[model samples]
Target chain A: MRRMLKLLPIRFLSAALIYLVAGITLGTLDALGYGSFKSVHSHLLAGAFFTLVIMGSMYQLLPTIIGAELKHRSLAEFQFILANLGFISLAYSFLSNYSFLKVAGLIAFISFILFAFEIFATALSVKDFYRRSLAIWFFLAAVVYLVVGSAYALAGVLGITSFSAARHAHILTLGFVAMTNFGGLYELFPMLSLKKLHSRRLGEVHFFIANIAAIGMFLGFPERGNLFILSSLLFLAGFYLFAYNLTRTYFSKSHGPEVEMDISARFMAYALAFGVAGVTAGFTSATLGFPGSFTHVHLILTGWVGLTIVGAMYHIVPMLTWLEKYSTKVGQEGVPLIQDLYNKPLAKALFITLNTTLALFAFSSLLPALSIFAVPLAIAFLVFAVEMLLVLGR
Target chain B: METLDVRGLPHSERPQLILKKLEELGELEILVEVKPVPVITMLESKGYTCEAEQSQGVWRVKIRKKQG
Candidate 1:
């Protein structure tokens, strides 16, 4: 059981890296005047890369945070298998055969349902009221989004309902991916900074606002009605509040000697900045009746979600590797510090290059000449993938 | 016996500090704002015994060296 628990996260992370590389390659090719691979690229990155990482992290961290053992371990393993098969098939559907989407969507939907059940059961099994932190709330809500989004996608694939692809994307991206990130930051910002959250009440408010706005946007998006516009504005407000709360939390004073920020922490900080920028771009595009445009989508996916995942992997991969490889040797023999598990110089280079290139990529939407940045952007993602693999190897 | 308060220490630093202190004292108690599950897991893997209780969002953990 212990061994399985230790390796589960690593397995998911390894798969996510593979999808990340494939997704970036397709994205870069499209940017460099290759055939349109938009559907395939989005599926591999968002459906596979982001979703897999979130699953891995939740499987690893949720039990620890809730002070309970993960419920239905075997189910989680099975879900992982189905999730990969589903996503891989879904990505292939975009490239070759549309009929494959029915099987793919069904598999993905079932996998997420199992995940939701496992996570919810684990949380409910724990009775500690205080253990139900802001992160848990966000995670639970994101699970709801994941299940709903998958169902919506499946319906589209089966032609059971005429659903807007844009709506499906929003549900999954904002509702599932962004919500998970919100929860993650709530937990990680405090842990990383050695400070208690700046304001739990404010976080609660942000949660409500965000969730309500998400529903409102879902209902309003297809029609582009007043509700959609209102919801978008509300979401932007909630995001600002979230950004403010976490920033204050990260910068809050600690009791001990001040510690310098590490590469992982730096990645998170920059990712938050990108998140703010992405949402702003989204808001402007939405109000201008051009929501989900090339610029808006890239800013949100590549700039915000992509960077955040990379930053988080920096912390999670090393910590898990340390536990799996070195924990037993502690006190009996010397082991490398967790931070030393990954190459620092390469991480720094990835950070600087990825952020700069992503910004250029976003601008490239408006200025086509800047599309040349896609090659460097792809290289940065490749480096990130390699770095994570190296960390696991160590 | 010594009680180390790790209420505001960085997460990364807490395990190292506790390990250093435990090596010196052989047994130690820790006061932390959050349950240090990873630290406790690591200690147990290192052949230490840990007992923990929580009150008012604070965790008090008692660690003892492995019996020879």
Candidate 2:
């Protein structure tokens, strides 16, 4: 059961598909005059998709760190129920503005709190200061951020908090979801990139800078534009350090590979570039004091976050589950690395088309409405779906 | 009796770091053994609580009592 619960994180992340669906649905609804903004889509993606990944990663991280047995299998089962119900209620309330949504949201929070307690038990009992501890810290921090954001959203929904939409949205999206994803990268990038961690010191620095920048933006409020600017810069620096370390490590290794391991690595590399572009555009938009700066923000979430997660999915599920090992070896001489589990050429082409076009759309101001951004995104998704089926099901 | 047992210890730290951490967790009395001794012999030398006995290869030690 403990081993089984490990699969839950990825299971929850599959909820992000629901987010993409919501985006398409709410987009159509907007066309139909049901709602104007994509709030429901944003929440479903950031909250449900992101939370599920965090939960799943913990199952692997906790046992590695503490060597303690899971105290309760039922807690995860309850978590699955509460999270889906709460998110569904929240989504409905986003469209209908219903009061029961808050009740459901609160139930979800209570469920996560239980999950937190269980993981925290292992954290306290850990006998060694392992690297996996970093994973747990980020996961817990993400959960805490989730609780704070959810509580705020609940209050706002119930008319207890007044007009805190922008602030709460940033908290839920940037603080909770992004931070959690960053944690997973710290664990995975080393393994999948076929390199040792470049700078352990940077990991600590990045975490501090992230939390500090995030909190600074929160407390300073969005009205103080300069703080957000500073925070974003700090965050961009954090991202650069991460990219630099990863790239340096990738290049430092002396190995020849004609065939790419996972096309997902390209997605990660491109996502970093997109993230940089988003930051640049955001800065440019701010200095220009122009409208539609929010588009750059969404690009950061979708082009960067969305692409990174999808790319990582291409790597993680096959490797971690050892599904790659189950393949036939009759004609194969050298055992393929885990990254070799997928069809890279097709994925690489799709990811390149997907990311390049989408990134260009983010920065495209004068280019008369590239509504075709949706085309590459859908195509990329289809390609990824095929790769996933081939890699995971076989 | 004097003994030394190394199991379930971190590879990076070796016996020295483990002993340091163990020292921080409890009181350790100084008793030197020239040759490799069973864990019981070492525990007896340092007065560690012995609740059971075990052997690895040729060395053996028994923990028969709790140390306060």
Q: Pick the candidate with the highest TM-score.
A: 1
Q: Name the top DockQ candidate.
A: 1
C-alpha DockQ for predicted model 1: 0.49
What interface RMSD does each of the candidate structures achieve? 2.3, 18.9
For the second chain of model 1, what is the TM-score against the true structure's chain B? 0.91
- Candidate 2 chain A TM-score vs. reference chain A: 0.82
lDDT of 1 by residue, A98-117 (tens): 75878888988999999999
Instruction: Let me know the TM-score candidate 1 reaches against the reference structure.
Output: 0.94
State how far residue A205 of model 2 sits from its true place (Å): 1.6
Q: Each model's DockQ? A: 0.49, 0.02
